[model samples]
Each structure stands twice: as C-alpha cells, then as structure tokens.
Target: MAQSYATDLLHLIQGPPGTGKTLMLAHLAQLLAQDGLRVFVTALTHRAIHNALNKIPQVDANLPVCKIGEERLTGDLNVPNFETFDQSHFAEKSGGDVVGATPFALQSQRLANVEFDVVLFDEVSQITLPLAIMGMLAGSKYIFIGDENQLPPVTTFSETEAAQTSIFAYLAGRGQETMLNITYRLNDVLTDWPSRTFYKGELKASDEAASRRLNLSPEATRWDFVLDPDSPAVFLDLCHTNTTVRSRIEAEVVSELVLSLLMRDVAPQEIGVVVPYRAQSRLIRSLLRRILMDDEVNKKLVVDTVERMQGQEREVILVSFATASQKFAAQMADFLFQPQRLNVAVTRPRSKLILVGSHHMLKADEIVPEHKETMDMLRDLDRQLPDHHPAQRGYQRVKATRKQIANYYRLLISIMLK
Candidate 1:
C-alpha cells in the first residue's frame, strides 16, 4: 500500500521505473467518482489516454467512451467524455465535450476551449512545455506524472543540465505541487545498483531510498540478467544476435548460442531479443529461420524490437545491440545506460534478462565517450529550456521540441531512441 501525502489542487506525481503511477491515477479517479465528481483523465497521446480511460468501463460498465478525431476511433474502449485531438473529424461528434490530444493539436480554437475538473498527463517528460501549459489550461486541476530518470525528453536541449530530473522540479517551483518520494516501477534488488550509481551523488544509498525511488520492497528481486555460460555477467546490456552478416568470430559464436537457447522450451514471447537496427532485426530473423531448418533443435522461437513490446511483458528478455560503427556503438551505449530507457527494457521481463551478443561491439570507446566536443555541445544546448518550466506546459510541445532537437543532433539515435 502507498503512504498517502497531502497534494495541492495541482499535483505532480513522479516515481522511478516500477512505481504504479498509472494505477495511482486510476485509483484517484475512482475515489473522485465515488464522491460524484466528474473526473477528466488525460495525457500526451490519445491512444495512451484511451488506455487509461478504458479502465473506467471495467470499473463502471455503463460509463461511455467515445473516440473523436483522426484515429477514427469510437466505442466501448473510448472514454465517453474523452476525445483525441489528432484523430478523424470526431470533433463535430464531440458536441462540446472536452477530449484528449497532443499539445499542438489542442492549441486550436476548438479543443483547448473545453473545460473539466481534472486533467492528467502521463509520460509528461516526453512532451514539450507549451503543450503542457496549454493542457493545463483545458482543465481546472491538472495532474502530471512522469519518470525522469528513465528517459529525458529527446531534444537538442536534452544535454541541458536540467533535462534529467528537474522536469517536475521546474513545475513545483511554478505552483504545480509534487508528490515526493513515491515509486512504482522498481523493487529493491533490481534498483539497488542503479540507485548507487545514478542517484548516490545527492542522496545516501539505502534500501529505503531505493524503495522510495523504485517503489518496490527492499526484498524485491529482479529477473533480468546477462551471463556468458563461459563468461562473466555484463551489467549494462544491449545484447544482440546475428544470423547472417558477421565479420568477427565472436559475433558468430554469440549468434549460435542464442539459437541454442531458443531450441529449449522458452516460448518466443518468453524471450525478447531486440536489435536496434533494421538490418540486424532482419538478419537475425532470417538467420533464425535458417538455423531452425538446419539444426535438430525444436524450431519454436521469436524475435522483435523494443518498440513492438511496449506495455507488454515476458518471462525472459535478451536484448541485442550491435555496435559495428564506433559512433553507432556509442549511441547504443548511451541507450543502455540511460536509466529511464533502461528501466523500460529490463522491466519487461518477469523472470530473467539474458543479455547476449555484445562484448566486442560495445567496448569502452564504442560507448558513451567522454569527448569534450559532445560535452560542450550538451552544455551549450542545456540552457535552451527554463530551469523552472511553466506549470502547465503540455507534453506535446515539450516532447516535440525535444524530439526535433534530438533528431537534428542524434540522427543515428534510433530503434530504442525512436
């Protein structure tokens, strides 16, 4: 159970990987519904908001959910009072009702004009400031939830010193109060090392701190782990398997080993092997088929990318990252170390993470290099955003601005970065 705290009308809830931010929002809505308060739950993506609002039906079967917009969505899963901005011309169908949309979508004369009691923003860091502010304007009480440590906004200004954790900190300074020291994503055993590495600078490291940050029991255990039956474990893993295109002998051996694992009873969904590049995903898929044909092992196995597995979990996950290009490897290295994104991939597994396929690819020089040029670039762009962002900046502009910048600078940042 969560220890309750006092929150102002405007609430900002932030926790690490495993803290139940989504569930908290749902329960809060349920409580308000009990009081006969009409609650408007919203967020950056209409699809994501639909996921949240649809939870209403399971609780209250009669609650109507209507999707209005370009997505051409409507029906039972749609929140009756909800609307998506970028979807088909369902705005006419809305008939004066407020709907969910990206910040830029809501900036129009129509969507932004609606009113409501509570507006919620999830994955708040992914969007930009202008939209956050605009969304805040659409509702009386705005609730923003995010995990800054997992992934900062992918923007040119991302290297800005404030990009990592102060996302909600900025809002708190601007009258958007925060719900501090709560987490839903990670448990103790899993978050301990990262907590010591990532957050130890400002605060002392302990299970309490880890629990609060990760939102799990101190005794909680993690399932994902990378091991070479013949080698030591790698902590920050971007494991990949190759089926055809291979230059090095080690890469070949790794591919063979991955094939060997699939021959076992592990269901295709039980193990997720992700290679960031399309060439890699394709090569592995093709090779997997060929290997099954030639080998005596049972031919049951599966492979896919991280984006395809969002909001889904497995029993085991083996993520493969190829770093043939030194620069590409460096980018992959950053993706692996990024606490926010790292959380997303690792937490997808309920049992174990067998990170195979990258000892030669992501050598020290191949990953997050300490180059003066890049650091200088990061420091320069860091100042573009407000230290104290506007309280109501919607996720659209903030996230969009970040994406635009990230793409300009980190063109090679793809797969997981995308």
Candidate 2:
C-alpha cells in the first residue's frame, strides 16, 4: 500500500502499543525517496522525530536523510542536521531527499520555502489539529500514524473542544484508518487484557514474541514469584494504603526489586520503573541512589513517568501505583485510571511486567460516576483470573500487612511451581 503513492492523498495508520509503527514509517519514507519523491517526516517531539529517522538507514543504507533541529534536541541519532546545508542549496531544491523535524521546527526560515511530495506525521494522537496543519502546508500528500488509545494531546482546552480539534480522535474509528494487528514486543500473556479492552481484540502477538520469557537464572529464585519467567504478567498485591502522592513503602519495594534484578545479573539498562506521579518517581530514585550508590548504575536505569516511557522499551518494567487510599484515588481517578495512561504503562515491557499496587483501592464501589467505566474495566481483569490465583485471595488475607504479603508470595510460588 505504501509503494503506490498519489498526490493529494491522506492515509491514516492506527498502531497500538509495540506494533512497530515507526519501522513502517521508515520503510515508507525510504520507498518514496527511492521513487524520486521528496519525503518529510515530523512528530510532536524531538525524541519521536529521531526515532522515526533513525530506522531509515536500516531499510536502505544509502538514502540521504537529514534531521532538522539542534544537536541537543536529537539524541545520539547519526543523521545530518539542516544546518549542515547552505541556504542556497535548499533554495535550489537540491537538499536531502528525506527531512525530519517537529512541527515547530518545520516553521523555521531554513525550511520556509521548502516543499515535499509526501509528509508523514508520527504520534498524531498527541498532536492537535493546528500543529498538524503547520506540517500539512509543507506537502501535497500526507500519511498520519498513531494510536489514539495510547495518549491524547495534552491541552488546556475542554475535553469537548480537545476532541473536536484532534485529527486522530475525530477520524480514528470512522473507518478511515488501517490497523496494525501484530505486536512483536509483548508476549501473549501480557498482551491479552489490553488487546481485549483497548484494541477490540484485533491485536495478536507474533509466535516468537508470544513464547519469549525472562532469562533469569536460579540465583534470581528469591524473586521468582514476582519475576516469574514462566508468567509474563504478575501483580504483587501490596494492600497498603497511601493518603498522599508519595508512598515510601512502594518506593522501598521498587528499590528492592531493582536490587534483586541487579543481583541476578540483569543489566541495569534493561530495567525500568514507571510511576504515575512525579513525587513517587523522585522518592523511588532517591531510595535507589542511596541503595545502589553508583552513579553509573543509577544513570543506566530509567525511572520516570508514563509520558517519558512512550516509544521506549525495556526487558522488564515495574509500575508503581503509589496511591492506595480510596479517597485519594477517587480524587485523582480520571488521571490515574485514564485508559491511555494505563495502556502505555503496562505495554512497555518486552519480557516481564510487574504491577505493584492495592487492588482493593482501585476496586472500590464508591468511585466517581464518570470514572466508573474505567474502574470496571480494571475490575474485569481481576474477574478473569482463575479462582485460585494469588491476586484474588491475597487481597483479603494480606490485610495491609507486610508479613502477610510475604507469606502470600511463598504460597503463590508453590502454586506456580506445581
């Protein structure tokens, strides 16, 4: 479909998490450039622009690709910047066949007179209509690629106005977009719920990815219940409560998990900790710094919010939902249980995903009426578990006690082994 290009055509590709949208964009850009059409690529952020262009060389090594922006903006990607070319060269229409930039960078004087045969926009769901129009003016044909279920454009406008102004939200389910059906990052076990709840069960895992497991050795057996290689998705039920944004108990548990992974010889770079609140993230990082004490190791592990984890993957991802108080959770229900935020946080792991939180808090019946739909969706995950699963029984037995949680973990390991 990408090979057959025409003028004034607008195509949308809806790619869910881990579905390789950036790779498809790279191939499309290379193919158009080979056919003598100037291709321009832009996204909402510099990291996204770099991610799309970095894959072009893998498709075809000789394609002349140029990235627009300063060196500080584009990280570690080996692509030529617009500043390398003289103003007269671009004015003569003799610049690189493919150029990449953000919508803001597309407005620079250097590319003011430049135009392209095709313009591809990545992460369009996070882009508003006005920003999209800025890039649309630079080309005659267009291809928009993103997942509306991941993250919507951050805006101060009302939800109604935001939806009307978002191109992806407006045109997503109206039968105009092509859906990528296969994900290579998540195993089948980890892919099940999000696929059913968000993608209408259209997404499936590749055979190799479906069978993939964490390659932990016997030395890691201490954490086998939480990091079970056989089970790709594990939820540690820490039935504790936190009335505020920061939970010291959750931070301590996260640090212990990181230390355990490191002791088992997992590369620090292969582990990531994603939290919903910045205060929680800061608390976890501080605990890790004091425990690990090595600046190099500390820098290698990524500890950040869900927004920063988009377009990046790790072998193992630990999600910390720090608020377990019913009142506090209800107050922030819209942000905490937003489908897009939950989806992005869970789908970031390539091998294992560990979700640590109080299921009871999220399962409360008194949640705000507007967020009840999302709360029910989470409840469905618990309902689907086998009657004998630890998450089902542990919630009642642990009673917010650490010792009981540890006892519950031992029982879970026995069942898993049998």
Using TM-score as the measure, the top candidate is 2
lDDT of 1 by residue, 1-418 (tens): 1222234456666644445566666666655555444445555555556666665556655433344444354432455433443233443442222234455545664354545556667766555675567667766666777655544555654444436333454664465444334333333333333344344422222444232211112221112112222111123322332322232322233344454344444445454555444566666666555544543332334455554444445545555554534455455444433445544555554434444443334343524555334333222322222222233110110111333334423422232254
Give me the overall lDDT of model 1. Answer: 0.45
The TM-scores, one per candidate, come to 0.60, 0.88
- After best superposition, candidate 2 residue 177: deviation in angstroms? 2.1
Clashing residue pairs in all predictions, respectively, total 52, 0
Tell me how candidate 2 scores on lDDT.
Answer: 0.78
Candidate 2 clashing pairs? none
Model 2 misplaced regions, further than 4 Å: 1-8, 83-96, 158-164, 363-367, 383-401, 404-418
